[model samples]
Target: MSVVWYFDFISPFAWLQWPHIKALAEERPVTLRPVLLAGVLDRVGQKGPAEIPAKREFIYRHVLWRARQAGYPLHFPPRHPFNPLAALRLCIAAGSGVPATEAIFDWIWGQGREGDTIEALAPVATGLGIAEPAAAVADPAVKAQLKANFEAAMAEGVFGVPTLSIDGRLFWGSDAHDFALACLRDPDLWEEAEMHRVAHLPVGASRL
Candidate 1:
């Protein structure tokens, strides 16, 4: 069983999920499925968090509180409503080596101005031995990979970032953590959960 996490850089909930999501991988392999939240939102025709100021702030504070309880350092990012695709692409490319990705993400979310450009993401990428700062951002292959990842996520019924999928069942919220753990521990539980999810869904939704 694998857990594929979808997240947008702009999401504080994703921020909340980051620390605990690792637990699902202990003694097990959890794949990080980074996808563009904006891309998923496009298919769902939903606006991002920035559009819902009051609701976003409410959710942000709640998630931040959870992060604090989880012992993660966090602060409201300095730049509100920022674009994170450039930053996210680096995370996807970094794959298992997401220390740089976490650093940049934490720095920005901890009230830092690190999301200004793809140029800024390069230093983080270079430090990770993945690519030169300029090369990764400029490379068409990186762009295409990011785009493809987003598309695949869309196909998976992923409508947001920070989504975790296990054993082909999609869990949309941080609150679904327990069920995710259950799916990871038992293959039979996974099969049961998969059928439960499919049974609830309407016709035409296929696993992607």
Candidate 2:
């Protein structure tokens, strides 16, 4: 079975996890699906890290620290929480393959550039042979595909970006990469008694 990767250009965490996910292509097919992070947050009725002041500061520092420790380049885009619709649509227009995803991620996180608008994304679009970046990304089909991606992610119970769906199981967050790899190599890991126990654990209280 193929791996389904749900990501959003708006997340630095997604950028951090991208390399490892890209490497998975060597072993198995990885489908790169771009969905709007805001849409997912809205669907789950939660605020983004950036929407919380203290959490925003913490996330920026935490990702930088993680990147430094991992030897991955880390650069914040000119702005945080910028609209990523254009970039997402551009990926759809580019066929949503590894190269296109890599270039777009590198453009935003690798180079600390602005990527919210068509003009800002022209370079990446041109590189991908999309002469009219605006027209290509703004095409009705491309827009619909992005919406469909978001809907599909929701249907799969995806609540965040950088989520990997393997064998119908979801492993979320960059921190969970190891667990995901472990599960991938040994699918029976989920069949352990303790795994089932935790999966059905009852909640004692509700936040509301």
**What would the TM-scores of all predictions be?**
0.81, 0.98
- lDDT against the true structure, per candidate, is 0.70, 0.92
Please give the lDDT score for candidate 1.
Answer: 0.70
The C-alpha RMSD of each candidate to the native structure, in angstroms, is 4.5, 0.8
Error of 1 at 187 (Å): 4.4
Candidate 2 lDDT, tens digit per residue, 1-208?
6589999999999999999998998778988899999999999998988999999999999999999999999889989989999999999999999989999999999999998998999999999999889889879999999999999999999988889999679999988888999999998997799998999999999877
User: Which pairs clash in the backbone of model 2?
Assistant: none
- List clashing residue pairs in candidate 1: 6-161, 6-162, 7-161, 7-162
The candidate that wins on TM-score is: 2
